[model samples]
Target chain A: MAMIETFGLTKRFGSLTAVDDLTTRIDGEIFGLLGPNGSGKTTTVKMLTTLLTPTAGDAHICGYSVREHPRDVREHISYVPQDMAVDPKLTGRENVVFFGKLYGIPRPRDAAEEALARMGLLERADDLVRTYSGGMRRRLELAQALVHDPSVLFLDEPTIGLDVAGRRKIWEHIIGLKERGMTVFVTTHYMDEADHACDRVGIIDRGKVIVTETPGMLKASVCRDIVLIRSDDRFKGTFPEGVTFLGRTGNELRFEVEDGDEAVLVLSRLFAENGMDIRSVSVRKPTLDDVFLSLVGEQDEQTAFDLTRFRTMLRRR
Target chain B: MIRTLWYVERDLRRWLRGRINLLSALIMPAAWLIFVGMALPIRFTDNYLDFITPGILVLTMLGAALQGGSLLMFDKILGFLQKFLAMPSPRESILYGKILFITLRGMIQTTVILVFAIILGAQFLDPVLLAQIYLILFIFGILLSSITTTVALTLEDHDTYAAFNAMIAMPLFFTSSALMPYDQMPSWLAVLARLNPVSYAIDAIRDLQAGIFPAMTLAGLLIGAFVVLLISVIIFRRATV
Candidate 1:
């Protein structure tokens, strides 16, 4: 049986449908719900974690329904929110042990130490979290969530607002969790991270799931190869059998071909034969970003006001 | 029950670390005890400190209990509420934990003021009577903190919650029989004081100190606290993060 399943799950805030007809099944694998802001990613996580009640339908974790058996569902899952959750006034060890106690762990102190060590926060475990850096604090949050050894871990934008190194470190820990046979559910808008990190991804847009596929399959479905040529002149004739013209923007010419390497050779010779001076030529494999844009169109950067996020930003100062 | 205590331990642990928060919480009540209780010379009483000590103790609990709302407010504002609500423990644990912690902290702060009041020439009551005073203060703390924590659950931001604290804390204190006897006040002011929950507690403690058992007042305060707590619990169980 799948570890996580949602049956037509829906949540509405007044007239706004935050999550609409979101139905999917996730087995014990690293699953990514990829979407832009306000695309219902967080709302879905909240509902599945038993934080917010669904307006319609229901979800199950480890075969326990979130609506009917929320306590059992909560017992099998742990959630790390997008915001920083560590208590700055308490020591790192205290924060983890606090969660351990809440989970009713038999040995909270030992469990806290083990979780802290796994997150590489053991050395600083005695220091107050207020003294830790942003990255260290994020790691501490992970330790706190993992103290109970939950089977399915839900991370809502776990690496948001972190440096490149910090982001990579968090992903490494996440990958380690999957290796240990834990089903990990994560959400993010960084397409490149999802492309390489997630075993399967579901692209959600406007509170609906647009498509669910492996990253490779999603990219392959969009286009196998994209060939681009930066030229001083446009090709007057394109009598190619396999290559199809994509579009032209300024002095750049774009095309889709069955094979990138073969297209690179053929397109270069074709440009020379056409008497077009090619400034640059390159063959690129389609990325998840490309697939997302093709499926969901452009995303508007401006999102509605999130009061909790705003208050979090204010308190950080 | 243990899970609830864990929640209380979390807040208590944090509250203990912030020495400034601890010191600042006592400063206002201490000022009131010293400036108004000691310096004020009223013709109605020879020792105003004895009369005002019960009032100051309740005021101390009032301040601490009202400020208790901010404990939950900070957790909500700082994103801890999401982590906490998603836990396996019952949701009432969080609400009960905050109320318990606020009440416990109030007891500690009022203990300090009681000792200080005695040192400043206020006649100390018998041990049994002092214990009764603590009981009245405990009941009052529970009643006020439950309401404030529930209010915190409904408010969206900390500023609005702070505004609420300022708006209610002072009026609740002044309109009660904290500063003067109800008989000394005008007719309208006496009526409001008689109706205020704060006055029920203060009057009970004062009656206890005066060798009169205010059985009816004590029973009324207990029932009021239990009813308010029941309503707060019902509201809290329905609350979502």
Candidate 2:
């Protein structure tokens, strides 16, 4: 059974459509909503979590409609937003216990303790959250979300600004949740995170899901073998078979080929015969970044996929 | 109900931990009671402290309620409001919890101010009258906090929220019957005071201190609090995340 599902879920802020006609189903697996900073990932998560009402359409979590039965939907789900929600003045234990009480757990303290232990925060559980580092605070947020043992967990940009080690720790914990049979719905700008952790990824652009598939399938479907050639002069004429010129950047020319090995040999021979001085030649497989670039087009230097830039663009619009 | 209490408990614990906030709450009201009460020589009663103590108490309530509402604004900015909104509890529980915490803070500040008044040689009222006065303060706190909550939720940022609160607090305090008797004010000011909920609360507290039951004033404050609370809940429900 699908643990979460949305049909034509739309949310508009003034004249801007933050989420437009989002239709998808997230079964009992780790489903990732991969998008750039302003691609409406957070807006969609907000609508799913019942923090924001949709302008149109519907969503369901654990068999409860988000619009008609928000309380029930909330009961079955937990959300960890990009910002840390735990109070800085309160201790980790207090934060989890408070969340437990909010969920009406019968034994809030025990539940809090168990959650803290799960997150490996049992030792510093009595310390104020202000004393915690960024990673520990993120863990505390995850612990608070898990105190109720929710069926569906939503994490929005869970490792957005964390260090490499910090992100890895969070990813381990998220994978652990999946092992415990919790359906995880995560949104992130880190393509590598989604590629490695997500069971399936939906690439959202301009408030729409442009593609939904496993990471491998998405890479395979969108991109072919890329042949990169660096030369001093531009190649005006191309006579190589099975090689199609793609585009150029600086002094490098790129081409898509059926087979990288054959293309590389043919291109090297052709370049030598044509007296072209090749600086470098290499064949590489397409990554998620390549797929994203192809789908969303290239972003300007100032409009890169960073939260601050995204917020600035949002404010301007 | 339990979830509401949980939120109230968390807020109270946080407020108590911030000793500066507690100290400031007491210091502001005490300063007004001592400085303002003594500087103004209106002899409505034997001791000026007795006369202004109730008014200062309302002022304290106003400040506490505004601060309480600003906490909500902070939660909204910091994204904790989204966490609470996604919880299983009813949305009203969040509003009620904050209001309850604000009322408790107001009651504490009022108690501290009352103690300071006694230190300044103001006589104490009867226990029953004291209870009645606290009840009136509680109701007044609820009304003001509800208004603050609505305004805070409506405004977008802390600066705007702070400016709006500061702009309104002084007028609400000075225009009410807190510092002077309503009859002693100019006729136009008296008319405004009659319509001010703070005036009704302060008048009830003053009457209780003078051993007179303020039935009409208490009724007005209770009704006003209920109506404002209902409006606040409605606004909170419609509040965008």
Candidate 3:
């Protein structure tokens, strides 16, 4: 059964629709909402977390309606917001304990301690959050979210702005949550991270989900494997039956082939028979970045301008 | 209700850790009491300290309430309020917790000011009258805290909130009977003082000090507190996001 489901979930700020008819289902697994800045990812997370009421439609968590039963939905889920929500003046243990109390747990102290231990923050749990590093603060936020043992967890850009090592640590813990049967729904801008961490990735652009599929399937659906053939002469002749010419840059000719390895062998033989000497041949698989770019298009000047304007509005607010 | 208490407890712990703020809260009222009591003439009572203690107490409560609203503003800016909004607990719990914490801080400041007033030769009332004074301060604390909370939730930035606080705080204090008797003021000023809720509280406290029960003033304070609290809750629910 789907633990988190949304149907036509929409939010509007005056005339601008932040989330437009968003419909999706996330089961008991790691699902990622992938988008760039100003793509409505955070707005959708806010709606699901019950921080903002949708202008239209509804969402459900663990069979509870978000609009009709927000409290019940909150009981079954926990949210780690994009911004740092932990109090810097309080200790890590105190932060988690306070969250536990807000959740009305039976034993807030034990729950806080256990959560800190899970995040490997037990030793420094007594220290003020101001004394902790950025990575530690992010881990503490996760610990606070998990103290109540929520079945589903929503993370908005969980590892954003973190160093590579810090990002890896957070990813390891998130993957561990999946292993423990927690339904994890996260939004992120890093395509590579989503490819590796999420069981399924939904590519959202301009407040609409463009595609939803496994990482490999998403890549495959956009463009096939590419076989790069570098030769002294530009190959402008007809291609093989299974190989289609993609593009050429300088002395290299690129072709989209069903099987890159087989195409390389066939293309090399064809080049030699055609009296053309090949300099180098390489087969490359398409990455999620390629898929994302193809689907969302390159970041144009208008999109960049929109993002800056959006950030300014947010800051003013 | 337990959840609300938990928030109050957390806030109290944080407030206690902020020793500098606590010290300042205590010192400001005492400074006002000493300066105003010594500088101002005493016409209504035999001792200036005795005449102005209730007014200073109300001033302390107002400052504490403003601080509470500032704290809420910080919580909103820092995203702590988002955490509370997203939680499973009732939304009213957050407002109640903040109000209770502000009232408790006001009460503590009131006590410290009362101690200083006594040391400075202010008259003491009977036990019953003292209890009534505390009750009046409590009601005033609630009223001011609610108003501040509503303003903080309504304004978007701290600079605007600070401006609004400054715009309202001094006028409310100066126009009230905090520094003088209501009858001693000009007719127009006396009318404004009569309309101010702080005037009612200070008047009630002064009446209680003179062994006169202020039934109407107490009832007015209660109704005013209730009305402002309802408005704060409504604004809080709408403005949290």
Candidate 4:
């Protein structure tokens, strides 16, 4: 069964459409909702996690409709929200145990200890959360979400705002969950994280999923080899066959096509045939970020509100 | 029910271990009782402290309930409310458990104040009067905490909760029968005070402290408690947060 399925799931914030007509299904795998900042990534997570009810449609998690059986949906999922959930006044251990008990995790002590140990926070468990670093608080938030061991994990920008070491630590823990067969549904902006961590990536833009495909498949579909040419002047030979001609800059042309080795050789001679010698030639492979930007760039003009909110949040950070 | 109880136990233990919240919870009421009661000597019909004791008790209940409300807001801002919502406990049980915890917490604070009052020579009630006082305290706690719980559940912001507590605190205290006998007040004031449920609570407390167990006072307090609890539950059940 699909771990999560949404049909026309929509949410409106007054005049603004936070999420619109979003329909998609995520099976058992590390599915990344790849978007830049806003793009309704958090809002989508909120709806699927049952934190915010959809204004228009429905979402099912672990085969339970978010509307029909919210609790059942909730029982099958764990959400790590964007905010650092630890109360500064409480000890780290206290924060985890408190949420553990609430999540119906039996033997809260053992669960909390295990969580702390997993995150390397066992010795600092007695320390007040106020004293912990930002990364540590984020770790606690993660620990709180996993205490109950739900079937699906909803991580909203789980590694956001963390330093390199911290991000790697959290990623390692996520890999541990994957090894245990937990179906993970996560969202993030860092292209490398998705490329490294997710088996499939869903590029969400303007409150819609542009495409859901394996990371490799997505890259192969949108990006193959980047063709760059630096000419003194004049147009190059007829646009490279089966190649996407990206815009050019000052006597230079760029495009993407499959079979870079053959394509590069053909392009080199083609420029030679045009009686123009190229100063520089380079081939670029597709990164997840490029595929993401291309899919989102198409409708980027319409979703101005997402950009505005993302900017405001970024300014705060 | 069991899950909620465990939640309550975990929360209470965690909160108690946090000195800042616990100390403030106990000290806020103590300060009001000792400082405000000492400064205001315009007695109603009995010991001035006794006259205002019920109000202080009500104040403590309100404070504790506000704490409960803030805690709810914290859960929301932090996303722990989702954990409870995910559970299969009766949907309304969340409200019930929270209200119960607030009510119980209010009762404990009231008893501590009562003990302090006794130690300070605030005068003892007869056996029946003591029972009536306890009964009145329970009703008042439930009523006050219920309102706070509803407000807290509906609101997800701490600043708004703080502002609400401040906005309601002074008027609920100064305008009630805590400082003066309802009959001794001006006609216009009496009419308004009668409408304030806080007045009913104060009157009930004053009746208990005066060594009198007026059936009418007890009856009014009970009805008021029931109405407030009913309204609070409705508001809580409907609130999306």
DockQ of each: 0.50, 0.48, 0.50, 0.31
Residue B231 in candidate 3 has what lDDT? 88
- Using lDDT as the measure, which candidate wins? 1
lDDT (Cα, tens digit) per residue for candidate 2, span B1-241: 8778888999988988888987888798899888998787675666777788888888899889888888777777888888888888887888899888889988998898888888888776467877887889999999999999889977768899989988988888888998778668999999988888778888888888777899988888889899999998888776744
Instruction: Please say which candidate is ahead in lDDT: 2 or 4.
Output: 2
Residues A129-247, model 3: lDDT tens digits: 88988889999999999999999999988998899999999999999999999999999888889989999999888899999999989988988999988887755457779899878
State the C-alpha lDDT per candidate: 0.88, 0.86, 0.87, 0.76
Q: Count the backbone clashes (under 3 Å) in each candidate.
A: 0, 0, 0, 0
Task: Please list the residue runs of candidate 2 whose C-alpha ends up more than 4 Å from where it truly belongs after superposition.
Answer: A225-283, A299-317
Residue-by-residue lDDT tens digits, candidate 1, A1-317: 78899999998776678799989999878999998777889888998998888889999899999999999998989999988888888999999999999999899999999999999999999999999988899999999989999999999998889999999999999999999989999999889999989999999988999999999999999977989889978678864888989899999988989888998888889889988898998889999999999988886667678777645423321
Per-residue lDDT of model 2, residues A98-216, tens digit only: 99988998998999999999999999999999999889999999999999999999999999789999999999999999999999999988988888999999988889999889888
- Model 1 chain A poorest ten-residue lDDT run: A308-317
What lDDT is reached at residue B25 by model 3? 81
Q: Residue B12 in model 1: shift from native, Å?
A: 1.3
Error of 4 at A30 (Å): 0.5
Candidate 3 per-residue lDDT over residues B1-241, each given as its tens digit: 9988988888888888888987888899889988998787666767778888889999889889987887777777887887788888998889988888899889999998888888888876467877889999998899889888778877768999899888988998999998878677999999999998778889899898888999988898899999999988887876755
**Cα misplacement distance, residue A189 of candidate 3 (Å):** 1.0
